[model samples]
Structures are given as C-alpha cells and as structure tokens.
Target chain A: QQQVRQSPQSLTVWEGETTILNCSYEDSTFDYFPWYRQFPGKSPALLIAISLVSNKKEDGRFTIFFNKREKKLSLHITDSQPGDSATYFCAASVIMGYKLTFGTGTSLLVDP
Target chain B: EAGVTQSPRYAVLQEGQAVSFWCDPISGHDTLYWYQQPRDQGPQLLVYFRDEAVIDNSQLPSDRFSAVRPKGTNSTLKIQSAKQGDTATYLCASSSLGGLNYAEQFFGPGTRLTVL
Candidate 1:
C-alpha cells in the first residue's frame, strides 16, 4: 500500500504566480515531512522540510504548510519561475527512522 | 565535501543474468539508504544501514536482491537473477545523524538498470 500520496499528478502556473501542491499520508507515526525537487535525468534534491512540531516551514520562496491533525501537507511555491519546472515529491518519515516513504510525485510546469 | 557517488551509471542485462551496483556515501555520514524509482513514479526505499548494520530491509525482495555496507562508508547492491520487472533507477542517499540537521539527505546520480 502507498503510505504517502500526492494530488494533481501535474500542474502548470504562470511566472510570478503562486502554485500549491498537496500531499497526504496514512501513517500517523510519521513525524518528518520533506519536499524534494528533481529535474529530468538528475537526482532528487531536498527543497524544504518540516517537523511535526511546527505548523509550517519556509525556505526562500518555498514553503511547507503542514497540518498534523489532518495528516496533510502542502508545498507552496511563491513567484514560480520557469526554472522551477520539475517533478516535486513529498516524503514522510519517522524521527531517526531508517527510510523515507515517498509520494508518487507532482510534475510542475512554470511558463513565462 | 563530496556528495554521494554511484557507479555504473547505466546497465543492461538479460533475464537471469546477475548485476551489481556500487555506492560511496559522503564522508562522516553514518546513515545510507537505497531506493528504487520506477518510471514516472517516486522512489521507494529498498533498504538502509547505519554504520554497516542494516536497520531495515523489509521492502527488499529477498529472493533475488541483496545489499551490504561492510565498511560503513560504501555499499553494494546485487541482484542474483535479473527480471524485466526489475528495470528501474537505483538511487543511493546518505545523511549524518549528528546535531539538529539529521533530517536532510544527499542523493547520488543513480544507476539506471534495464533487464531485458
């Protein structure tokens, strides 16, 4: 079974606009949530991460809003740029856990 | 500092053939993980180790897959018999458990395997 799930298999937004990608998880034991950005033919890179203790985390123009009670999280890209076009993956893991459970991913496209 | 490195960037094998992939994690990182990513899908964890000791490997297919991190710095994943279903990109990632930055992991370029 897929423990982590992401919505909107694909998305498109204009430059300077804000885009939101949603994610949900089934395991309540999960405490750490991270977002990864991967360009084609490259490895996934860490974008932003949030611990359950916080309701939100931000890095530059990327922000992660997490709702632990709802078992859901969303990644917001402010001022979306064409360079930001890539596949975004939502992942969850337990603190000190050995592995991360990843969602199917969302393909984002930012058009100038 | 160097990032995680993987070798044999691409491999092709016939069914029933055997293959191995190697990975070298960053220095001073004690945790290493392997993940399998199918086309258009997210990566799934296959196994992980903390300083040469496997912490979890429940997702690995034991009948054909095996992995080892004997030196705590490098690891190898071997498949005894290749199958078409095994075609995927294998990724290696590493992270340090020290301080408050333990949640981040560095990934390798990955090895793309194709089983015909």
Candidate 2:
C-alpha cells in the first residue's frame, strides 16, 4: 500500500516558469511533511517542510500549499531556474522520528 | 559542521557475498536512519536508531540484514548474503533530538552497491 503518492512522474518547463509538484498521503496521523531534492550522484537534501497547523509555508522562491482536509499538498517553484532541475520527493512522518514515508519522486527538468 | 558521511561510496559483489556499509552521522545528532533507494523509486526506510537503541527495523530483511549502533555516533549495516535484488543505493540520514520530527534531516552521499 503506497502511503504517499506523487503525480506527474516527470515535468519539463522553461526557465523562469513556475512549476508545481503535487503529493497526497493516506495516513491521517501524518502531521509532518517535508520536501527533499536530489541531484545526480548525490544524496537527497531537505528543501522545505510544513507542519499540520500551517496552511502555507514559503522560503524564498519555494512555497508549499497544504490542505489538511484533502490530505494533499503541493510544492510551487516560482521563477524556476535550470539549477532547480532535479528529483523532488515528498515525505511524511507521524512522529518526530526518522522513519519517513516517502512519495515516488518527481523528475523536473528546467530548460534554459 | 560536517554532514552525515558514508563509506565505500561504491561496492560490487557477487551473489552470496557479504558486504557492509558504514555511516557517521553529524556530531551531536542523536537520531540515525538508513534507507534503501532503487533507481527511479522513492527511498524506503530499513531501520533507525536513537542513542544505540533501535527505534524501528520492521522493514529490514531480517534473514540477511542486520544493523547496529554501538556508541550512538556511528552505525553499520551488514548484508550476510547479497542477492542481485539487493542492488540499490543505501542512504544514511540524521536529525537533532529536539527537531527529530520537525527538523529536516541531513543525508550522506550514499553507498551504491551492486550484487552481480
């Protein structure tokens, strides 16, 4: 049972365009949500995250819009750049442990 | 200031061979986690430890896999008999205690193991 699912396995957009990646979870107990980015031949790095109480969290050009009722959330990258092209994973956890349930990653390619 | 560090960045072994991977988490981080990531797939948690005690390892293939954190600073994952199906990248991550759940984790470069 896939506890977390992501849409659009792959995406391509021109530089400066806004790109959106969507994620949904099945576990209601999952209150911690985080987005990670992975580059070729490297480890996945934390990009941004959100808690249940917040509907939105923004850091610079990255924004996360979360809906608790729908059990869904999205990552929006404004003014995307070529450097932002990488695999993005949405993860959730029920508690403050490190056992994360991850979603199938989305491969984003930003063309210059 | 150092992030999580993993050893044997790449390993190749034949079926039935034994292999081990090591991880050194960030200093002062109390929680450590290991994940297996197949090509194009999301990472799957295999095990985790908090101060030398295992928190969860239900996903681990008990028959062939084992993990340990003796001093609470570093960890080792051993595969007794590797199989071709075990080919994947092993990732190590760590987070602080106060931010264990809320604080994002730092990841290592990972060890790519190939079982022929």
Candidate 3:
C-alpha cells in the first residue's frame, strides 16, 4: 500500500531548463506536504514545503504548486543547474509532517 | 552548530545477528526521528520522539526493532535477529519544537546496514 506516489522514476534536463516533478497522495487528511532532495551518499535535505491552506509556495528558484482538490502537487525548479542533480522525494503528513509518508522518489539528472 | 550526528556509517551483518545504531541530535532540538530507507526508495518513518516521550512507533516492527531516546538528546535503534529484508539505510533526524525550522528536520549521514 503505497500512500504516496511519484511519477517518472528518473528524469533528465538540460541546465537552465525548468524541471518539473509530480507527486500524489492517497490520504485526503494529509495537511502538510514537503519536498526533500538527496545527493549521492548524503542525507535527505528539506527543500520546500506547503500546507493545505496554501496552493503554492516558493523559495527562490524552487516552487511547489499543490492542489488539495486533486490531491496532487508538483515541484518546479526554474533555471535548473547541474549541481541540482539529485533524488527528489515528496512526502505527506497530517500533523506538521512528523510521521511522513514518502513517495518512491524522482532521480533528476541535470545535464550541463 | 553541528548538525545531527550518527556513528558507524556502515554495517554488515548476517541473518539473526543483532546490531545497534546511535545518533546524537542537534543541540537544543527536542524532537527526534528515525527512518528506514531501502535502495531506490524513499525513507519511511520507523519511530519518532519528543523529549524522551514516544510520540509514534506504529510503523516500527515491535518484535525485531526497538528505539529508545531515554535522555531525549541522544537515541539508539536496535535490531535483533536481523533479516535480509532489513537491509537498508537507517537515518536519524532532529528538529526544534517550533519556529521556521519546525518541520525542517536536520538529517544525519545515516547508517547503511546490509543484512546477509
């Protein structure tokens, strides 16, 4: 029973291109959505997040567009860089995301 | 300030063997979390704590897995009678109770465990 699901197990984009990753969850009660990126051999780091109250959240070049009605979300990386190559994960939770349910993850390879 | 710290970054064990992983959370953080990440998959929550109190551990395998944050600052996860299915990376994370970094868990390097 995969609570969260991500599309395109792997993706590649040219530097400076916009990279989009999609995610969806089964639980309608989920109120918190956070994105995390993990570099090879490193731990997952929080990138950005959005709550049910907001449909969009932006942090510099990274933005998250969420649709509560659709129970879906997407993370967009504008001006993607080669250094941004990593595995991106989408997670959902009901209470501030303490008990996170993560998707399979998207491996993004930015070609410079 | 130092981020969350985990010791013995790698471990290899035989089936039925027991192993323990340790973690030291960031200073002043009251919440701690432990996750199990299998290869090519995202991390899954095993258990979490808030100031030595077990908030949730329903995802943890009670028979073989047990975690303790006795003092709340440092914690340990032990797996008894490890199985091949237990092979995965064990990650430890910490965060403050409130503020801008509320859900921003500071992760450790993680322990890569391989059960043969």
Query: What lDDT score is found at residue B107 in candidate 1?
Result: 95
lDDT of 2 by residue, A1-104 (tens): 99999988999999999999999999999989999999988889999999898999999999999999999999999999999999999999988535689999
RMSD of each: 1.0, 1.1, 1.2
Fill in the DockQ of model 1.
Answer: 0.70
Model 1: per-residue Cα lDDT at residue B4: 92
Pick out the ten consecutive residues of candidate 3 chain B with the lowest summed lDDT. Answer: B95-104
Task: Provide candidate 3's TM-score on chain A.
Answer: 0.98
TM-score of chain B of 2: 0.96
Instruction: Give iRMSD, candidate 3.
Output: 1.8
Q: TM-score for all predictions?
A: 0.97, 0.97, 0.97
Candidate with more favorable, higher TM-score: 1 or 3: 1
Q: Write the per-residue lDDT of candidate 1 for residues B1-116, one digit (tens) a residue.
A: 88899999999999999999999999998999999999999999999998999989999999999999998989999999999999999999999877774448889999999999
The alpha-carbon RMSD over the true interface for every model, in angstroms, is 1.8, 1.7, 1.8
**lDDT at B90, model 2:** 99
Residue A100, candidate 1: Cα error in Å is 0.6
lDDT of 3 by residue, A1-112 (tens): 9999998899999999999999999988888898999999999999999998899999999999998888999999999999999999999888776778889999999999
For residues B1-116, write the lDDT of model 3, one tens digit per residue: 99999988999999999999999999999999999999999999999999999999999999999999998899999999999999999999998857663377889999999998
lDDT of each: 0.93, 0.93, 0.93
